[model samples]
Target chain A: MNRDPVETLLRQADWAAGPPSASRVDLADRVRRLARRRHRTQTAVRATAAAVVVIGVGLAVHSATLRHRLDDRTVALPPPPAASPSPEEVAQLRSQLAQLQKEANDLAARIRSMTAIQEQRERLARMERAVARLESGEEVRAQMERAAFTIVYQADRMDRELGLRESALRAYRQAIRLFPETPSAKVARDRLAEINTQGDRL
Target chain B: MVDMVNGPALALDGDPLPTEREDDGLVARLARGDQAAFDALVAAHQDRVSRLAYRLLGWSGDVDDVVQEVFLAAWKALPRFQGRSSVTTWLTRITINECRSLRRRWGRVLHREPAETGRVCSPAADSRMMNGETLGRVRRAVAALPVRHREVVVLHYLEQMPIGTVSDLLGVSANTVVVRLHRARAKLKNKLSDLMQE
Candidate 1:
């Protein structure tokens, strides 16, 4: 009987094959890591929101507490300090006044710190917007000298997008010169050469 | 252009093959978030999947890794399994993509070692075809086929799948599969004959 070629070839394959080195533990761990990262990000966001709420509540309560303490002290003042009130009343009065002064000082200090933080956050938000505009391929060279890192990154991108190798090379060199030993400078130099080589092929 | 002309002609006259009802049901269950059904699918198709990967790329230490990755990708993409194509066909498509990626990585390594082409070269012989030198010649000939012809021939002859099923798996018409198989067989016969005479 003539043998079948298809059957003969099919018989050449091994019937049993095993799985790879990837284990159940590794797979489970990977899934868990993904879940944990998502959870951590959520928790961080909630915590920051909660901190803001807590600070607001603390400021409100402190304000109320100071108002009440000052009111009670004013109402309970000795009658014109007749014949010089007892040493205990004098001491208590002075202590309350001193506390009011201390509370005012503390509030002023907190206000100053809050103002500074607000200013910093506003600056950061503007910088983030500038960075976003640069990323979206817009030219915002107003603050190039002030923000050198962003300027270099945007220049490098512009050079690549415009296909101007020499211009890109110059920007990278400038970045390296200005911010020597910085990661941005190093990355700029590396990418500049990579793009230059690619340009050569063209 | 020739393939495009032939493609529609074959498709119009293609034979209708048996539907992969069981595999389809299993995949549907997997798409509905049933891990058990997905596991069953993996257990069912693991061997054929491994063999295809091994034969296409040669039996390397990475064959099993490729197979596992293929299954994982299948599991992730099961929800998008439109029933237009059979589950086996979908699996074959994914397997081909994975094999191509591995081949590309190997090509990069070979490029880096420009002086030595043989280091990353895939010898046609596999562990299963370790019968004799003649079989090795047959192996090399089959491996040398272009990917399209090679896929149809492998699924048809080596996997012992019906021509219609091979056609469906390849998303091509039965007649196209027929012509490819005919060409592949002719090439193999010629190559094998030359090797045998030596």
Candidate 2:
């Protein structure tokens, strides 16, 4: 091909035509950020999984150790005294039974409290997932209103039980502001005012 | 022409590798994951990609999109590149592939219709040509050619790549490239005839 210098020159001129106004730096930064986030998420998931595995192993080992210790304790404990009708022995036996009963009751209460907390966390997680699926803004706002209502009701009930009316009233006022059409806020306000009046008299 | 048959070292003129100090700096820095090197690579190759896209799409809006995609695709593939060819060759091949893909979607609009309007024209070259004017003009002329013709013209003429190298890039025969160059030059002469007549 006979290369015409002028046409060749014009063709070369076209190569100098710059890229669009969009920043390559921004593009690179975006790529870097996404890469870093991917690394962090992967690391976090592995770390969490590893922690769970470690905790599970530790619990299993501890449970085995405790079972062995219980066996050892049963073996080491002295035999019960002969079944003789004695007043002092009966009294000591009753006291020991009472102590064991008390300990059992305390453990049961703690278990129930822990179970309730876990249930609440699971409920919140479910709500979060539901919120994620609700694409409609109105639906999300309605959910927010319901949450606010429930929070105000719970806070007021807690405050009454715990003797903290002012904080409860503030929560009720927030709920009213968030959803003015609700009746919970009206009843809370009336009750709070009554509490304030009583406090003033005191 | 250097004998390309022996090894890449002897294949100097159509090596597709940049010989400039800045390009050397870029390769070294890029190996180190330097952000500046990546940016520089985009900056350097963007125009070449865009020009190829404009020619392929015939001055369409898809040029910028294709150009950006080409660089992005190059970035992704850069890590895996085994250095079989030079970075310019690798980038140019990517740009050419991207342009062809766009061509397939757009279905080859050769003759500009009266209805088709408001294409983002290439940046107006400074009328006063400086040091790089010869190469620049050749690039512009190559960009104004049809997609198929422009590929060979760019690879062979401006880049000074051998017909065999152009063939590999386009997945066509060396004979096809020679023929395309012949036709492209004829078309270029016709297109630039008005300027020559003036």
Candidate 3:
């Protein structure tokens, strides 16, 4: 029978793939040991991964809370007083203002009193001059009285022209009392009687 | 030329071992930590991995160690079986890898245990055609082929893998597998020419 020599040769070698000599018991025991080791390793790895994930979540939550607290603190805090004055500074300014107000009031009172005293002093000096002129001589006294009555007549006339009836009446009476015999005094008495008649008519 | 004298090696090419659905089901059960499923898996593939390792390494002493390593690896990976190939093809890949690892441990040198065959036949010769002497000669001829060529012959002829499957297992093009098979056959032919005619 003719045959392909190589095919014949391969067929001859097929026994190399014969039934294995390894028993089922031996292989089973080895496979069992391998399975146990694999189980243990997988369990350890999973536990470690779960721990890592939990710790990561905890850290994230803690960080977020800390940030929120810091933000709240920032919002609650007052801003620095860059433009507005502080309480101490405000108190100092008010004290200075009060001191200035008191000084101003005192100065006004002083000026008013000084004005009254100056008026009194002027009246006293005028009386003293009148006395001095009366004591010098009768003729000089009459001349002085006439000069004073003339000045009074001029002021009364100006006062009457300027619509100061009361002032004019007072000036006229003063002239009559101080220089009763002078010519200006007679004129003053006539003007006074005329003003009195006019007042009575009103 | 279908010159099949032994039924088992040729039979594997025609007969399906387990379907993809069976593999998918097995993987699912194994993934769920099903101990019985793992046992069933080891029982099913142990013999095949053992035989393939024995042939590839050309040594019997190393076959059991290679087979156990293959199963231990399978028990771990069967749960994650991707269904890219059948469980049978996937297991065969593991068997080859383990065999290669063992050989590498010994610096890629395989000491052929004198061809021990009580079963198998040749077509051009008698049914029981010189089982010891002739088989030994063929085994030496195959082992003498280059590593790439030798694996194709062992897978395509002795292990009865489809060319495409052998190609996939070796991570090469089908054409490349075919080419290697051709070259391996030619070399074996040249080596066994005088013996086959005897």
Candidate 4:
């Protein structure tokens, strides 16, 4: 009847039985579900990470393209200043110069007409002294007529210099009245006719 | 037969029962994720696994949970089985580890003294074979042993594993198991004199 007491006690302790079958089945099912859930979660995380990577790569490519385009535009700018002007631009510049030349010619013509009147006045003053010394009656009459014509011409030049078109027309009419047959009166008559014909075109 | 032996004598009676071929087939099917194979495996070894957990944890309700944990671990580890040990031995190792973890976790939370006086047997225990009060006292005395000694006692006596098998399961030397068992029996004798009396 001699035996180990601990061994005997353990053999006699019959409470350590397996659990019911239902629990085993339930546990097996729970473990399978957990494994499936883990697999699905891993797949979803991988897909989300892939999408993020693709979006990041696309943005990087797009920015690079935009940068390249900007760089191209900058590089394209420096060549234009070195190039000659196009034919159409040259034609437009030529037209502008011609208009400027026309304005200059008109200004010179007015200045020349003013100088001519001054010269005429000086010649008439000398002619008056010649007439006082001459003995011929016709020569004296011609000098007197010439002096009257020079005075009318001076009035016309003064009105034209003041930019007074109406005053210039009146001065021209007066010149024609005072020296109807003289050369100065004939030049004034021709100018009055030209101004009337030009009218508002001036 | 209580010789105060230095080493555990092999249980020649119930040894050599399950063939290695049968275990190999079951482990193979488990590795293939066959549910029927797993069910068959659990049906065959549930009792042994439950007994080890119950004895280790002093018959707490966590026994069933520990058994499920052990099988689940076995299922996961089947592919790496390498046929080094029998399925029973491998499961026994896992059960012991789970019980140890549960005890440590519960010990921290409840401030358990490890050797507390309490009823170790459930109400369903057979009273005719052993007096319920004496059995409860013996169960508590065994539960009071340190975790290492309790593991040796439970695997040696309750689960009926040999010293070599316990050493293999615990990954320790056979001499270590013998010394631990010798010390554990000495403590049990000191604690349960009334139960040990002829």
Number of the top-ranking candidate, with lDDT as the measure = 3
DockQ per model, Cα:
0.05, 0.04, 0.14, 0.06
User: Each model: TM-score of chain B?
Assistant: 0.67, 0.57, 0.79, 0.76
Give candidate 1's error at residue B137 in angstroms.
2.3
What is the DockQ of the complex in model 2?
0.04
Candidate 3 overall lDDT versus native: 0.63
True-contact fraction in model 1 equals 0.09
List TM-scores for all candidates, in order.
0.42, 0.38, 0.50, 0.49
Candidate number with the higher TM-score (3 or 4): 3
Question: How much is the lDDT of residue A97 in candidate 3?
Answer: 55
Off by over 4 Å in 1: A4-202, B1-21, B59-62, B108-132, B194-198
Where model 3 places Cα greater than 4 Å from the true spot, the runs are A1-3, A16-18, A35-202, B1-16, B112-128
lDDT per residue as tens, model 4, B37-113: 86777777775666556667775443555776777777677678776777876777788888788877778212222
Off by over 4 Å in 2: A1-25, A30-202, B1-36, B109-146, B156-168, B171-174, B186-198
Q: What share of the true interface contacts does each candidate keep?
A: 0.09, 0.09, 0.42, 0.17
Higher DockQ: candidate 2 or 4? 4
Off by over 4 Å in 4: A14-27, A38-202, B1-17, B32-35, B108-129
RMSD of 4: 60.4
Model 3 / residue B21 / CA error / Å: 3.6
Candidate 2 residue-wise lDDT, A1-202, digit = tens:
4546544444324322322222222445544544554466557556655755665566567557756755675667667654343477557656855665565566556556655665686578557745754764545554454455454544444365334455566666666776665555566567667878988999
Q: Highest TM-score, which number? A: 3
